[model samples]
Target: MTTLIETFAALSDPTRLDVIERLMAEGELPAGALVENTQMSAPAMSRHLKVLRHAGLVEQRVAGTSRLYSVRPEALKAIADWTMDHRTFWEAGMARLDAHLALEEGEGE
Candidate 1:
Protein backbone atom coordinates (compact mmCIF):
# COMPACT_ATOMS: atom_id res chain seq x y z
CA MET A 1 0.00 0.00 0.00
CA THR A 2 1.07 3.60 -0.54
CA THR A 3 0.77 4.21 3.15
CA LEU A 4 3.25 1.49 3.97
CA ILE A 5 5.79 2.99 1.61
CA GLU A 6 5.14 6.45 2.96
CA THR A 7 5.61 5.24 6.53
CA PHE A 8 9.05 3.94 5.65
CA ALA A 9 9.94 7.25 4.13
CA ALA A 10 8.62 9.17 7.12
CA LEU A 11 10.64 7.07 9.53
CA SER A 12 13.79 7.47 7.51
CA ASP A 13 14.05 11.17 8.33
CA PRO A 14 16.16 11.88 11.42
CA THR A 15 13.74 14.37 12.97
CA ARG A 16 10.82 12.12 12.24
CA LEU A 17 12.71 9.23 13.83
CA ASP A 18 13.19 11.37 16.89
CA VAL A 19 9.47 12.06 16.92
CA ILE A 20 8.71 8.36 16.77
CA GLU A 21 11.15 7.64 19.58
CA ARG A 22 9.56 10.25 21.77
CA LEU A 23 6.07 8.95 21.16
CA MET A 24 7.21 5.40 21.83
CA ALA A 25 8.59 6.53 25.15
CA GLU A 26 5.63 8.69 26.16
CA GLY A 27 2.61 7.00 24.60
CA GLU A 28 -0.32 8.72 22.90
CA LEU A 29 -0.36 12.48 22.71
CA PRO A 30 -2.17 15.22 20.91
CA ALA A 31 -0.44 16.83 17.94
CA GLY A 32 0.19 20.02 19.83
CA ALA A 33 1.57 17.99 22.69
CA LEU A 34 4.10 16.47 20.34
CA VAL A 35 5.05 19.89 19.06
CA GLU A 36 5.64 21.08 22.59
CA ASN A 37 7.55 17.97 23.55
CA THR A 38 9.77 18.07 20.47
CA GLN A 39 10.21 21.84 20.41
CA MET A 40 9.29 21.79 16.73
CA SER A 41 7.11 24.38 15.16
CA ALA A 42 3.48 23.34 14.97
CA PRO A 43 3.62 23.47 11.19
CA ALA A 44 6.76 21.34 11.06
CA MET A 45 5.30 18.78 13.42
CA SER A 46 2.12 18.81 11.39
CA ARG A 47 4.03 18.02 8.23
CA HIS A 48 5.91 15.20 9.94
CA LEU A 49 2.66 13.87 11.32
CA LYS A 50 1.09 13.98 7.89
CA VAL A 51 3.78 11.67 6.56
CA LEU A 52 3.36 9.31 9.48
CA ARG A 53 -0.38 9.22 9.05
CA HIS A 54 0.00 8.58 5.37
CA ALA A 55 2.32 5.68 6.15
CA GLY A 56 -0.26 4.14 8.50
CA LEU A 57 2.23 4.26 11.35
CA VAL A 58 -0.02 6.41 13.47
CA GLU A 59 -3.72 6.72 14.13
CA GLN A 60 -5.42 10.04 14.64
CA ARG A 61 -8.72 10.74 16.29
CA VAL A 62 -10.63 13.87 16.97
CA ALA A 63 -10.85 15.04 20.55
CA GLY A 64 -13.08 18.08 20.31
CA THR A 65 -11.00 20.75 18.58
CA SER A 66 -7.79 18.69 18.70
CA ARG A 67 -6.50 15.62 16.97
CA LEU A 68 -4.73 13.09 19.15
CA TYR A 69 -2.17 10.80 17.63
CA SER A 70 -1.05 7.39 18.79
CA VAL A 71 1.54 5.01 17.56
CA ARG A 72 0.22 2.01 15.68
CA PRO A 73 2.21 -0.87 17.09
CA GLU A 74 1.04 -3.21 14.36
CA ALA A 75 2.78 -1.15 11.74
CA LEU A 76 5.94 -0.86 13.85
CA LYS A 77 5.92 -4.55 14.65
CA ALA A 78 5.69 -5.37 10.99
CA ILE A 79 8.69 -3.16 10.28
CA ALA A 80 10.60 -4.66 13.18
CA ASP A 81 9.91 -8.18 12.06
CA TRP A 82 10.84 -7.34 8.53
CA THR A 83 14.11 -5.83 9.70
CA MET A 84 14.76 -8.77 12.03
CA ASP A 85 14.69 -11.13 9.09
CA HIS A 86 18.01 -9.57 8.05
CA ARG A 87 19.09 -9.26 11.65
CA THR A 88 22.13 -11.51 11.52
CA PHE A 89 24.49 -8.84 10.24
CA TRP A 90 23.60 -6.28 12.89
CA GLU A 91 23.20 -8.84 15.65
CA ALA A 92 26.57 -10.33 14.94
CA GLY A 93 28.17 -6.91 15.17
CA MET A 94 26.38 -6.22 18.43
CA ALA A 95 27.48 -9.53 19.88
CA ARG A 96 31.06 -8.69 19.06
CA LEU A 97 30.71 -5.27 20.60
CA ASP A 98 29.24 -6.84 23.72
CA ALA A 99 32.15 -9.20 23.97
CA HIS A 100 34.60 -6.37 23.50
CA LEU A 101 32.98 -4.29 26.20
CA ALA A 102 32.86 -7.21 28.57
CA LEU A 103 36.52 -7.89 28.02
CA GLU A 104 37.42 -4.27 28.69
CA GLU A 105 35.30 -4.20 31.83
CA GLY A 106 36.79 -7.44 33.09
CA GLU A 107 40.25 -6.07 32.51
CA GLY A 108 39.43 -3.11 34.74
CA GLU A 109 37.84 -5.36 37.40
Candidate 2:
Protein backbone atom coordinates (compact mmCIF):
# COMPACT_ATOMS: atom_id res chain seq x y z
CA MET A 1 0.00 0.00 0.00
CA THR A 2 2.83 2.37 0.84
CA THR A 3 4.51 1.56 -2.44
CA LEU A 4 1.29 2.30 -4.26
CA ILE A 5 1.07 5.69 -2.59
CA GLU A 6 4.65 6.45 -3.51
CA THR A 7 3.99 5.45 -7.08
CA PHE A 8 1.00 7.74 -7.29
CA ALA A 9 2.93 10.61 -5.70
CA ALA A 10 5.84 10.24 -8.13
CA LEU A 11 3.44 10.23 -11.08
CA SER A 12 1.66 13.32 -9.77
CA ASP A 13 4.45 15.42 -11.27
CA PRO A 14 3.85 16.15 -14.95
CA THR A 15 7.49 15.77 -15.93
CA ARG A 16 7.83 12.44 -14.17
CA LEU A 17 4.56 11.18 -15.66
CA ASP A 18 5.75 12.22 -19.12
CA VAL A 19 8.99 10.37 -18.57
CA ILE A 20 7.11 7.19 -17.67
CA GLU A 21 4.86 7.52 -20.73
CA ARG A 22 7.82 8.07 -23.02
CA LEU A 23 9.74 5.16 -21.58
CA MET A 24 6.72 2.90 -22.03
CA ALA A 25 6.21 4.05 -25.63
CA GLU A 26 9.89 3.80 -26.63
CA GLY A 27 11.37 0.70 -24.90
CA GLU A 28 14.47 1.25 -22.77
CA LEU A 29 16.19 4.55 -23.49
CA PRO A 30 19.40 6.13 -22.28
CA ALA A 31 19.29 9.04 -19.87
CA GLY A 32 20.52 11.35 -22.63
CA ALA A 33 17.79 10.23 -24.99
CA LEU A 34 15.19 10.96 -22.33
CA VAL A 35 16.54 14.47 -21.91
CA GLU A 36 16.21 15.38 -25.57
CA ASN A 37 13.18 17.33 -26.86
CA THR A 38 12.46 18.64 -23.39
CA GLN A 39 12.90 22.22 -22.18
CA MET A 40 14.38 20.98 -18.89
CA SER A 41 18.12 20.56 -18.36
CA ALA A 42 19.74 17.14 -18.14
CA PRO A 43 20.20 17.51 -14.40
CA ALA A 44 16.53 18.33 -13.95
CA MET A 45 15.53 15.27 -15.92
CA SER A 46 17.94 13.21 -13.84
CA ARG A 47 16.17 14.34 -10.70
CA HIS A 48 12.80 13.29 -12.10
CA LEU A 49 14.22 9.90 -13.04
CA LYS A 50 15.58 9.51 -9.54
CA VAL A 51 12.14 10.07 -8.10
CA LEU A 52 10.68 7.50 -10.48
CA ARG A 53 13.36 4.98 -9.61
CA HIS A 54 12.75 5.49 -5.93
CA ALA A 55 9.06 4.88 -6.44
CA GLY A 56 9.81 1.46 -7.98
CA LEU A 57 8.01 2.49 -11.14
CA VAL A 58 11.21 2.38 -13.23
CA GLU A 59 14.43 0.41 -13.32
CA GLN A 60 17.82 1.69 -14.39
CA ARG A 61 20.60 -0.24 -16.08
CA VAL A 62 24.14 0.68 -16.90
CA ALA A 63 25.20 0.16 -20.49
CA GLY A 64 28.73 1.43 -21.16
CA THR A 65 28.56 5.06 -20.10
CA SER A 66 24.82 5.54 -20.38
CA ARG A 67 22.06 4.97 -17.84
CA LEU A 68 19.20 3.09 -19.49
CA TYR A 69 15.71 3.30 -18.02
CA SER A 70 12.65 1.10 -18.44
CA VAL A 71 9.30 0.78 -16.74
CA ARG A 72 8.92 -2.01 -14.18
CA PRO A 73 6.13 -4.32 -15.31
CA GLU A 74 5.09 -5.19 -11.77
CA ALA A 75 4.42 -1.58 -10.91
CA LEU A 76 2.12 -1.20 -13.90
CA LYS A 77 0.42 -4.46 -13.04
CA ALA A 78 -0.24 -3.26 -9.52
CA ILE A 79 -1.89 -0.12 -10.85
CA ALA A 80 -4.07 -2.08 -13.25
CA ASP A 81 -5.07 -4.54 -10.55
CA TRP A 82 -6.00 -1.77 -8.18
CA THR A 83 -8.13 -0.03 -10.80
CA MET A 84 -9.92 -3.22 -11.74
CA ASP A 85 -10.59 -3.97 -8.09
CA HIS A 86 -12.45 -0.69 -7.86
CA ARG A 87 -14.20 -1.10 -11.19
CA THR A 88 -17.56 -1.62 -9.54
CA PHE A 89 -17.30 1.72 -7.68
CA TRP A 90 -16.51 3.65 -10.84
CA GLU A 91 -19.28 1.99 -12.82
CA ALA A 92 -21.81 2.68 -10.10
CA GLY A 93 -20.86 6.35 -9.96
CA MET A 94 -21.13 6.68 -13.73
CA ALA A 95 -24.51 4.96 -13.72
CA ARG A 96 -25.85 7.37 -11.12
CA LEU A 97 -24.52 10.33 -13.12
CA ASP A 98 -26.19 9.05 -16.31
CA ALA A 99 -29.53 8.57 -14.54
CA HIS A 100 -29.39 12.11 -13.16
CA LEU A 101 -28.64 13.53 -16.60
CA ALA A 102 -31.50 11.58 -18.15
CA LEU A 103 -33.92 12.85 -15.53
CA GLU A 104 -32.76 16.44 -16.13
CA GLU A 105 -33.34 16.02 -19.87
CA GLY A 106 -36.83 14.64 -19.29
CA GLU A 107 -37.73 17.63 -17.11
CA GLY A 108 -36.76 20.00 -19.90
CA GLU A 109 -38.83 18.11 -22.51
Residue 41 of model 2 has an lDDT of: 99
The residue ranges of model 2 lying beyond 4 angstroms of the native Cα positions read: none
lDDT of 1 by residue, 46-77 (tens): 99988888887888999899998888888888
Pairs clashing within candidate 1:
none
Whole-model lDDT per candidate: 0.83, 0.91
Cα displacement (angstroms), candidate 1, residue 37, comes to 3.1
Against the correct fold, how does model 2 do in TM-score? 0.91
User: For each predicted model, how many residue pairs clash, with residues at least 3 apart or on different chains?
Assistant: 0, 0
| Cα lDDT tens digits for candidate 2, 1-109 | 3378998998999888888999999899998998896999999999999999998999999999999999998888888989999999999999999999999999994
Candidate 2 Cα deviation (angstroms), residue 51? 0.8
Highest TM-score against the true fold, candidate: 2
What TM-score do all the candidates reach, one by one? 0.71, 0.91
